[model samples]
Target: MNTARLAADLVEELDEGGLRGSFLVRDLHTGREIGIDPDVLFPVASLIKVPLAAATAERIRLGELDGSAQLTVQPGRISTPGPTGLTRFRYPARIAVDDLLYLSMSISDGVAADALFGLTPPAEVNRLLRAWELHGITARHLLGALSDTPAERLPAEEGHLAHSLAISSGTSGRGHRIQQLDVARANTGSARAFVDLLQALWTTSKIDAVVQSRIRELMGTNLLRQRLAPDFTSDATTWFSKTGTLLNLRHEAGVVEHADGQAFAIAALTESRISAVHQPEAEVLMARVARVLRDHLRHG
Candidate 1:
């Protein structure tokens, strides 16, 4: 199979639809890889959690932090505006640090992710990446900070509707800028670099095997499957992935293992020109492209 040709064809098709995308697929067993614009930077959205998880695990391994320790979470402090997990809580709550890690990665929980980021700052996460020789990625800000509106940062007010409006307005402006592919101000990475990170996580003997296994386990339980997982996953084939979404950007990266012992690391990141808040077709397009690449790798 001419994997390169297939990738080019896929890119052409995506371009005709007014979408910009970057993809990379590497067969872990065979060292075969394919990509299209895989080195170009894209906004990573929640995908940044993978590195944060790695950093936290490393800290725990070094005995610098206790993953099992309880952390108190208040509604306004370290909270991001989102509907999932801890962000939905109306009041203060106590959660285990390790469990928070699970919530952040498995469910893409914004609040839980921000909480972990507080413990492992973005600078520390980037430093670990550099030490590991994964230089294609950057962790510059907490998840909450990425989408935070000025209104959200303001002191809590008595009127809920007024606060909601303010948040909505701020989010709209941020979304506009993000839709422009503002890489400088967003958490960014290239598909090829992300593949390198996944490879390191899977093949590196430098990190504790237990930590690697835990990261994979949490990723396998990820709730967002509309992008790459829906196309490559089956009862026999398993996908351990993390997804990132913000406005017009959609991305998923993970390792897909087949029942027959074949495994591949895939990163599919896309941006659509459509301004509609909900663009189901963009998600479907990503899934379809992934399926094309996976099939070609398996049988092409």
Candidate 2:
């Protein structure tokens, strides 16, 4: 099967489902790639946590921060509307920097991500990416701001406001307030840039091998495997990925490596026109698209 042609057909299928998507697949060993609308930017949602994790690892390597150091999670210290891992706790708790990285990357924990952002700051994360020459990617706002409620209401541990915001955003029509928060000012990235980042992380000599291994391990343990993993993973294959999800956006970026040593970097980003609160088909379509790309490359 022709990968490029198949990718185009998949895009059309997604369009029929009221979705617009971008895809990129690169052979890590040969440096050859295929893409459809790969340069178009999409709201990355929680995918930004990948870069945040990289920055934190870099800081640990540089002795600027300690991964084992315990940080207290006070009330209102970090808010994301939805709490996961340590963020789900009521009273204050202490967590290590390394564990925080795990929660942020593996489970897309918003509070864990915001806490790391507090330590490294969004601007600093962007600066680190720029230094690495990844100019097309941006991590602009903290995860808490993505929620629809006011800042004071943000720290609600129950996640009621976040759930309500997600529903309203998905159901609203064009030009809705959620659109403003997402398209106008949300974290953004192109499929190609994300693939490039993954490639760098996989093959670059600049990042310490130990740190790189740790990051990959955390990503490999991601619990949300319904998006891209279901298609490509098997006994001889493993996927290391981070997923991003919001009202109408669903994305996953990662590297899939086979036991035979072939590895490919893949990024699939999508936006939907469906204005319903639930769209399970959107997730399934995204995975189908990914499976097509993976099989095309693996057996082509």
- Cα RMSD of all models vs. native, in order, equals 5.5, 4.3
Candidate 2: Cα lDDT at 31: 86
For model 1, how does the per-residue alpha-carbon lDDT over 1-300 read when each residue is reduced to its tens digit? 376677778888887765779898888877788778889887798889998999899898889989999999766444434447777777888999899999999888878988898899989999988888788888877787545643344554433433334223334233333322356666789898888878878876465787788888888899877777778778999989999976556888999988988889999988766544456777888878877886787786
Cα misplacement distance, residue 106 of candidate 2 (Å): 1.5
Tens-place lDDT per residue, model 2, 18-105, is 7788988899999888777899877788889998999999899889999999888654333443345655556777889989898888
lDDT of 2: 0.78
Q: Which 10-residue window in model 2 sums to the lowest lDDT?
A: 171-180
Going through the candidates in the order shown, the clash numbers are 1, 0
lDDT of 2 at 188: 82
